[model samples]
Target: MTDLTGTSFEFPGEYYEIMRKDFRNLDAETEFLASLLPDAGTVLDLGCGTGSNLRALRERGHRGTGVDQSAAFLEYARAAGDEGISYVEARAEEYRTDERYDLVYSLFMTLNYLDRGRLPAVLRSVRELLNPGGQVVLEFGHLLNFVDSFQPNSVGHHRRDGVLITRLARQFINAHAANWRNEETLLVRTADGTVAMYDNFFDQAVLTGPEVRELLAAAGLTITAEYGGFRKEPAPFHGRGPLVIVATATPADTASDTAQQEENQA
Candidate 1:
């Protein structure tokens, strides 16, 4: 159940191949994350665009299910699915699965695209979808990094499947607010000088580490490990770049049940 009218919008099926290709080299990060799940079981890959991480999970001996809103991506993922990989084409915020998972993951800054107010509900869903003691690994950009490294405008380029991706990023730095906007264009240069082009827009709300921690706490999940890089390096109080947050499931409404049990025992 996806709202057509939302601040966050994804190009239908348009970015699937590109995204899959772009993420193929993330094996190092995947291996790092896999190390955390020494005893992997059923794992939920929320916002699993193109099922890349699900592929990684299957390689690591875990049953994996992926959820995404992109019908096009799901189509590709289904064709790409292996023996134990399944995908659900639905919005991450609204997807419901009958089975509980031993681990849940929403990585690659996927949650940042969600509305701040809806984050608690998302985390609650993650917790509910997991078994007791299940863990969630969340990865996102470090807001402090943007504040510390403010480049008014910058450009970078990379190649994917012979397509040259040129990225131009702009920063808006103000007191209490720092905005980094990126404009990316992909150009595929054929041997004969022919070119194919694609464009996309991405915007997200800025939330600090403490704010994210509070939101997770409100969702009844306890933050067990917080790190700066995918390698699980310790995060400085105000360090930047990528951040990985590991949280374990905490049942919702524990206080009410505790009080009820106390009264019964009394």
Candidate 2:
């Protein structure tokens, strides 16, 4: 039996029996982040699937490392043969690094994968690994994107990098319990006529806006700004699409501490 369960069609990898489509609009996505991080020197990407964002950053001369839990994704990232960049196969909640970065980001609601109980620890770890005056960007748009957007069962497909991908998605919402369960079946086909299929289950934490703010504050991080989309525009009261958040450590001595650490390392 073919082990298709390990493959994801949304972020395709080389190991999948059938070619899959990678994430969409990667160039635009990375460019939007670049505008926000004009002077960023070092970057750490948490939950970086398939290394697309890291690859985009490296192309523009930013030193970057990607961390994710998928071996298949990491293998695909390493296969890109980019020596200047690195990939770590580890869970975002459990991973640690000695190096601090000028920017630490988790995109596409990656934080939702971690239990709410673990979010504070993740933030603390992010705080400890940030350089002075650095920033952390988190996009929790999934929370909003999924609202009123799911139909009973829907199928869609697109072609990218020569791979064709078809996905069937369904949602079961429990409003009383604040539970949103999504199940997706991906059918991938290579240009060479090979085919593969896999099922993915995503059950995420549905948090209120105020609850998120309190959680960030409790974690010693402050929300600097929130955007409605990639444009960096102010989020509307009842707007749709993804919501992005920019944050930083709340301590006053973080800059000095970072300077001291850099000097000691030097």
* TM-score of each model, paired residue for residue: 0.78, 0.81
- Report the number of the highest-TM-score candidate: 2
Error of 2 at 105 (Å): 0.5
lDDT of 1 by residue, 167-245 (tens): 4555443333233444445445544567666564454556678888888876778888888777567886665565789
- Among residues 3 or more apart in sequence or in different chains, the pairs in candidate 1 whose N, CA or C atoms overlap within 3 Å are none
Error of 1 at 33 (Å): 3.0
Q: What TM-score does candidate 1 get on C-alpha atoms?
A: 0.78
- Angstrom error at residue 213, model 2: 1.7
lDDT of 2 by residue, 1-266 (tens): 21112222344565232322243466667887676565537889998877878888887778778888877778788887556677888878888879988889998767766666777888889888888877888877445556746577888886755767787888677665455666888787877889988777765666656777777766668888888766677776663656778888887575466557769999
Off by over 4 Å in 1: 1-25, 38-40, 149-152, 168-181, 190-193, 251-266
